[model samples]
Target chain A: MSRVHDMGGRYGDGAVNPADNATFAQDWHARALALTLAAGALGQWNIDVSRHARETLSPKDYSRFSYYEKWLAGLADMLVNLGVLTREELKAGHATGVSELASRILKADAVAGVLAKGSPYTRDGAPNAEFKPGDRVKTRRPAHNIQVAGGHTRLPGYASGLIGEVVLLHGAHVLPDSNAHGLGEAAEPLYAVAFAARDVWGDEAGAWDEVVLDLWQSYLEPTA
Target chain B: MHFRAGQTRATSANLAAMPHDHDHDHPHTLLPPEPALRVRALETILTEKGLIDPAALDEIIETYQHKIGPQNGAKVVARIWSDPTFRKGMLDEPMPLLEELEFYGRQGEHMVIVENTPEVHNVVVCTLCSCYPWPLLGIPPGWYKSDAYRSRVVREPRKVLAEFGVDVPDDKKVRVWDSTAEVRYLVVPERPEGTEGMDEDALAALVTRDSMIGTGLALRPEA
Candidate 1:
């Protein structure tokens, strides 16, 4: 829940640190790989379900539905295939107690552990950056094409070395870009910043233009 | 009914405006565009199969082409220019205030507004897909939707902006924002100078749709 680092990778020092060798030291990389593979599998499942749904439903109706709703439908099919949930049970639940069943099934804790092996859940020490609002900073561009298994790099082509003002700091988190996109390990100290159009584009940039980017702490370095 | 009739007339006129270059040395180029043929075939199949009623397709086209798009952005610009406090509120949390206006669509509930200042310029792109601030700006422009624009803009923004006729000095940095989540973005272009005495409506009139998308600035009133 916290925005820990900006590099979109997890790195910290502490007791039971997820990134460290103490707790998950032995199986950390393996867990990360497995989780990455699982994510890819789930992504494929989502694509399949969405394609089928698109074929069956109108675009308007499909747009109105949430990703979670589609996931639940897909989950039902998967559960039925595994013989974990019978069609009769699913039908009965949908008929009379949809809300209750959904609430119980969708609890965060239930699925939290499933991805713990790959998640950045370290109890590491707090971040070091003293960045405040109005401070000028530049995003650290990660190496070009430096691929990591199951992690995404926080180095977006658009964000590299761009000056921005720190807006809000979302405490330590697994940088979504790196973790989900297979760029790098999850890190800490994520801050969302707003960039002025002029700062980004110069005088020719419409004086009124600006953009806000969510950056992991590691991706930023104080600018002169 | 009048609007529907007008739409048909306008569509036909636009179609007629296309260059009538029927002859081509290359047979491949001479063939009708593949996408056009695919669309025609799909329409025939859908009609024959009764998969979608004719009225539904008409409604869809009308909603997207006429009902949705740049007007929504224009309205937002007008409101922001008219009300300074609303502009502040928009900068604070674009989603909540936007929802208050009740002008939201799909993928708009999580919205963020980035402002462009005299010293900085901002542009947005989605490398993975053509993610845009549809709720505020409506559909993205044709250039934003193109793969070349998407792939190159994020990497070489200065060069790309030059292509769009926005020349940034070498000293000025070009920052590109990538939308990765369901959240959408709108660029709040800075209010231009020399418009101090102008009324809010007049100032609003200066705010162009492209300004909201971070591609250009609002036009200033001539002296």
Candidate 2:
């Protein structure tokens, strides 16, 4: 679905401010990051789901909110929707003395261990890779009314429905679209699909430049 | 009267050094005036409910802020630059080498290192959200997440690079790696000229965060 988050190929936003590298400019920003990570570390919602929640914000709010602030809003939304925290609790800014259902909180000492042993999206699967490096391919046209249906996707708006060459075959990895919707790990072969600037953005792009996207096998079709 | 170049530089430097000169704006002021208080309230409530551990929260903050950052990746790049065998290992299978050096896991789990040669320059951007290799590059810079970059980098990488003062030759192919999947990419920037006698540590000093992102060239030592 078209959203503020999907801004690829669109123009006239503003100059890329190169000097703004500070991770957290305010005290609340750090708290926002911490709360999101802590709440997410629980074995409840998936990363894709959290991302979808973040994208679901009104375009006005999404545009206005800073990166961590967006995370805070999304985290709050997810908690409320999941029935873990009530709206009253959020408004009151305190727990309502109700029993909490959070069973697997990330322990302080184990934070480093857990982060060091990161989440790998790959899963052992049966589908063999359909394409190899050097194979010519075209991206599948994304379904237009996806936002109305309500879900998540890794497919960028710009390179969808475009032709490209397979540069590398990443072995079976979890499909984020399915994972976001609580579907089973629909693992599939992923590829680094390279599209020429001309092919992606017409004559405006540099003649020699190319953009490569890591596309799943399901997002591609064979081409001569 | 026209000011000299030195005076102009001094004036600009003085202006930059001045604090709270005109605008002392905090974005949080627009949303809620008491965000810090609100955050503190949430933290206290969550802690009381046992939903979050304060120590764990501190640990997470510390890791991203200090423990891991661009310097870790810089070491890896410097090693690769100084040693051909290491470079071959990195190009062939980078995951193991990065893991051996403890730069694996988190966003750095599934890794691919793209080399920058004289003929081709490699740049990385996540057209989606900022899905960078946190363990390798630390948290991504703010501009990386800006709409201008997310929208324009793919269509005008040369223009973007020019803004960063990196002028890729027109003849050289510019390959923009859009990180769309879980696998993260790290660009092994080409070593700058006139640093042949420098050690790996010295070479590491030349590696800036932007060079790894392909926005800027590696620093050149004094000739």
Candidate 3:
């Protein structure tokens, strides 16, 4: 819940810059994006795992790296952790020796096809939704169990422990909480849960405002 | 020059903003004042190890930079308005519509289109990370992923929307979609009253990138 990346409602950040619309602020931003996507195609890790890797970076590194820079750093950490490449190769700017596991390098000819044909996260035959539209529910506060305290969770700290209502049933989809830790994919029913902005932010929020979250079933508890 | 661990996420951005005073004190910037060089070095390492293809990286960049972007999303939103069949197709299930228009791709595989109306207005944000619909809207704008946005929009959507020159009246409820899991959201702005005669391309022109993200209202017919 205290993860630096779980940044919702934490204040003192300045105004949102609508004029700052550039997709990539620097030349390296483009490279960082492509490199991360290309390297990810090697089949060693899923998007969830990569996100968890990024979230797990030291707080200083997390705060220091620009968004795309974080992508590059996370890519490096995952590559080394997964043994796809070594620390020496990264530091030396050359391979000390050929990587033994060159399992599924994405080729130029196949890049467009691979990107166009994105892998769908919905598992087959998985439609056991427990909640329906208009059903009230409360986001489960993190239990803080010793075993499960510090892994990646999609539930933002601000919305946790807050009561909300299911706005839409999104069927079943891959759960990041389990998948991020190499615990294997589990498709949980995902719903759009709407929390009143006043409840989420107290009296300062607009009277008619609400925040909706795409939450998995495990993150929600049925409320009276 | 180690930043205190307690510095807010904006510290890096703040440091970047104040170049005259901060740049000299901090010799290393961008985590390596040479981000381009660092990226090049990583590419070289990956290519040499047969771990990646440089041309593939170029392809990825080419696709995002030129082949697709917010314009693709414009076409989708315009279609939803100009064509009732397309609108129903989009509302019933968006995948086929996305495919029919060739707007389907990564970061956009799982999409839920939320429509705006007189009673309620919807906006999208990613509180945990920048989870955006890449193929439909291209890479998200920098502000969409900023600490200010990710931290504030969900809590005060009307205020955030107001900052973007969008004002939701108190009578009109505002909903902010925090895309946390695999789902990516595209907010369909309400069609203006007089656009019934507007052709598809004409309608498409009114759909600004921010409009689809629910941060701003779609441009009026004149715009």
Candidate 4:
């Protein structure tokens, strides 16, 4: 088994410089445009009405709004601005019956143009070079540059290079490295795996001490 | 912008000593108090521009901040502590079990309750964003929102807990729940000792907001 080591460095140290960070932010802003288009094209508001109640108006109404909402909201705002639908139409459709209105909007060429551009969602992270569940694997301790309050650096104070097994695939999420820089960057495939106590801390661990973590696919390497 | 190697070393030492505190007076700086503020500002603009009725904005702000989140959490906690079958139901299939409670928060239709025991510890974070089990634990804490906690907690559970003054023994395995999507997590912390005979209300009282969020354990009567 290869020993995973965390060569200490700053968060966002390897992937992004200050310049790349700016670019990432700009990319996120641009992506917001596409997200709005997709939402409009899909008649997301109507979908919300059917799923939630009439009282639930904006998708933002959903509690626990996060970074994703910004993109969706920007998308909706653009749709209204593009003359795809009058704000009144969107609002009225939200109240009662809007299937016909939604159908018309969904068919609009302008709306189609925006949707055709497709999603600005990007995949930006290390590629996973490991196998699926039941495969024995170990976590690699790559030196990560993390930004702290007053400054930024990398340290291995945490459980770095701990061994575990892949349990579930968590699709793609915004890479932590991209997020630290406020770049509004893309997501990567992540996994949820359970690590046995003995593997992580040897005999010191309790019999039931099993650690579960969501690791980026890139952070893993297959064990022989 | 010069990265002095020695300065970096000193900073790490300082962080180790101080262990970043979340009790900053400026709470809003940690999480966006902006959503509410922005809603208000939008309402004001709309009102001035005659875009919306005055009452509409007020309702929006009220529903989101006060009515939506904490109420959901309280209901879920109450339901689990009171009903045994429901407790088992929750442990078995958390998502459907949560719906039976009939108190759903935004993004909380899907839920998971991770059990925390004497031997094992659990904590939740939304590394990419602040995804929390709002239906079961209420709005997340400021520390949960801080980039330091989000990035470090999943990777370094013990160190992160230590910063929060929660020193789990090295023998105890820490499970960090990384919430994404609509799925959220609530920590079913071990029901503290001394409260074995306490009523549901008393037990609920002992279940501090932090315990629900998985930071600290539920309170027990002093020995």
**Who wins the lDDT comparison?**
3
Pairwise DockQ winner, candidates 1 and 4: 4
Give one digit per residue, the lDDT tens place, for model 4 in B60-167: 333334554544554456557677898888876765665555555344645567778777788876654455654454445445554456655554556666665678
Sort the predicted structures by lDDT, highest score first: 3, 2, 1, 4
The TM-score obtained by model 2 is 0.89
CAPRI grade, predicted model 1: incorrect
Q: DockQ-based ranking, best first?
A: 3, 2, 4, 1
Provide DockQ values for all models, in the order shown.
Answer: 0.02, 0.23, 0.33, 0.06
Leading candidate by TM-score = 3
Model 1 residue A163 lDDT score: 82
lDDT of 3 by residue, A163-216 (tens): 999988888887777665545466889899988888988999878788888888
How do the residues B1-223 of candidate 3 rate in per-residue lDDT, one tens digit apiece? 0011132121223212322222222212223346788788788888888878888888888898898898988888888887888778788799987876778878888888889999989899998889899888999999998989999888777778889999888898888888887788999999987788898899889888999999988888875
lDDT of 2: 0.75
Q: Which scores greater on lDDT, model 1 or model 2?
A: 2
Off by over 4 Å in 2: A143-148, B1-38
Which of candidates 2 and 4 is the stronger one according to TM-score? 2
Docking class of 2: acceptable
lDDT of 2 by residue, A1-224 (tens): 57678878888976787888786667677677777777777655666666776776767767887777677766666665565666666666677774444456778898888778877777785499989999999887772324325456777878888889999987898776766555555789989989998999999877888999998888888987
Q: Candidate order by TM-score, highest to lowest?
A: 3, 2, 4, 1
Give the CA lDDT, 0 to 100, for residue A108 in model 4.
27
Interface RMSD of each: 23.8, 16.8, 10.2, 19.4
TM-score of chain A of each: 0.41, 0.93, 0.94, 0.37
